[model samples]
Target: LGRWINPDPGGTIDGLNLFRMVSNNPLTLRDRSGLRGSGYIYVPFLSRDTVDIAIALYTQKYAVNKKPDIVVFSSRNEQLDFYEELKKRRSDFAAAMGKSLFEKYNTSDLSRKSLLNAGVKETEIKSTIMSIGNYLAINSMTLMNQQDDEIFSEISIGDKLKIIGHGSAGSAEISSGGLKSVTLSMHELAERLDFSGLPDQALQITLLPCQSGDELLEPVFIEGKSPFMRTRPSAAESLFYEMQARGYRRVTTAGYRGFGQIRGFLESTGSHHTQRKPNSITASDDIVRRRDAKEIFC
Candidate 1:
């Protein structure tokens, strides 16, 4: 809705060219503030392309796959929950690793040396670690995605399982069904994703087109009640509101429950050992949800 944001009507009516799309390439215009139109206006956003390379990678992977596929119904809930739980379970995981390989991982402090003691390869641990408040900033973007199916499209129910997680090691070899423990390095995860038929360029311009007469790809995203811990990205909600304002119908929602879609996705892929489906219901929007940003932030 760039056109809707056009405050000035002085432009020509023969299809106004008010907001020119800056070439997706990098530009120095943002650093140079002379381009700022007025005290209330700035062009920093023009330099940042809204395209999502992650989604593009998925679409590219989908295009290259030639084999028959079993499209599953699990949403992205399980993995999201796993990640959230991981943050809480880090110490536990470290303890487990330490018991397996001591001295190298426990360096008398929770440091990079701890990972080394835990038998984590040098590359698995980040070269540098930084923390802000309660959040520990890592060296990778992570294995997060729209759904677990997006990552495991190459595997099936009865195939030999080769799985990966942000932390763990060794491909587990067992009977027909058992949870394996193999950790994933950040760089390794990105590399594996590249090999998974996901185009590397998808990270920059992952686009999905509309049926027709629509300018942008629109998706319906059902979100959880907690804003701070939402499975879907923040942009999805903004787009939903923008589409709503544009009179679009058919709002997109996840599986039945608010936070259950992610959980379902995990259970579908054996990510969660005690996987259980979420229970949800159809409901109308709450008008007061928008009054305060804090209402959703947490």
Candidate 2:
């Protein structure tokens, strides 16, 4: 029953160590009396503790994340004949990060007196604690083209779109030149775009099996697509609606049910992977959307 998480945007770390869910409004912090009142500025004095965390700020006001030039994550179990649950979650996050790095060095020998007692300076605490210990090896990838279902992400298929509104992609790879490069790259990307990157229609969902158009080269299917009795919207919702109908702003890709995508992921309630949703059985244009997150463009 703990919370306050908020990290993992691109992931690096800042808000974690949860046990949240508090708000009765008494969580105060305000003071500003200037003029004839002489002077006052105080601020934030929230209190509540049977075991309250009450820390609105002051871990040096956090701001140190960004370490992913590229980290697709994958130990390879694309779920075809599996590696038994990614080898049991990579051996349980590597034995709970080696028992929390041996109780975090039992006492402390990080040298330079715990990096000036945490004020950090000793040459940036060995590159800031090995860069937040790299999210314990940022490992979690599963798309080896699932033996030809369909997926070929490199990103880029912009400039010709008719105006968002359509969907279809299926297979598990029996191959026909990977279904002619997934219908010759979606009919040369059924509309075209590439309007200056940043999420300008982030397309690339190819996994061939043959028939509609044939021509291949491996990747008939793997972890990208194959077993679809129904539902779809996984290529991050057609790369966020072909980059928000060609506008090029910020939020690059996020569709399948809006604001922050994939229902803002927060699972782990005994973790069996439910709560996903997003394939709303037909009726097109996301008929009012919901089942997760949305907003491929507008």
Candidate 3:
């Protein structure tokens, strides 16, 4: 299932408008801006398991047509939930830590002396306290979404689909029956992905946890001759590595961004620049350029 958006007069596409336009589709439709020369093309999936299946199908379909066949799995909903949970967990942890510190050190203020007296090493206190956030973030990412089990069970071995998500490293201990699995931290993921020298085609399954909204936690994507390569690890990159290590192939991952961030990326790449003769370009053409810019960045 698919839908196409024509550029508006200004060459900019309203994502909200495109979303409204495609509401009739029964499948969950994600819009990509730069494909087919610019407004947006909706990739509709009947279910989560079909996401990779559809992408693989489209990748082959576009490759056959001699177009740049790219598939991006954007974790907008996942990331948003993560961000909200992080904030709540951080606040709760802060309160709990403060209470613990006060009970142990006889003062509410956090300080080296207080932490040390409370039997917490000064060097580790900050991280130890914030670890709750990390724990919550990982679990949130790993938890299966609605109908995930049913969908996953339906996947055939020939299609080679893998589901990537976050969970306790201990979760791997549970029987996967015949399903393959691995677990790693973000840091470990970065090191392994770089050392593995794995081919893109080999990444058939991807399970991404909710990513940190903190810019510092996000991975860096270096857009050069090879646009999709990661130059550095982000909090979410580790999940990518875990997916690879576990042995599912044909993986595609993309970062989640709000509208403002998306616009900023576009501006940085000069996508916002008006065409030489603005009047000559249709609205759809301009929207296509913006979408194309996003595709390049992704």
lDDT of each: 0.25, 0.27, 0.32
Which stretches of model 1 miss by more than 4 angstroms? 1-76, 84-88, 94-298
User: What would the TM-scores of all predictions be?
Assistant: 0.18, 0.19, 0.21
Number of the predicted model whose lDDT against the real structure is largest: 3
| Candidate 3 structure, TM-score to reference | 0.21
User: lDDT tens digits, residues 68-132, model 3?
Assistant: 22222223454345346546655765566565543443334664334434555463454443333
Ranking by TM-score: 3, 2, 1
Error of 3 at 139 (Å): 29
C-alpha RMSD in Å of predicted model 3 compared with the true structure: 20.4
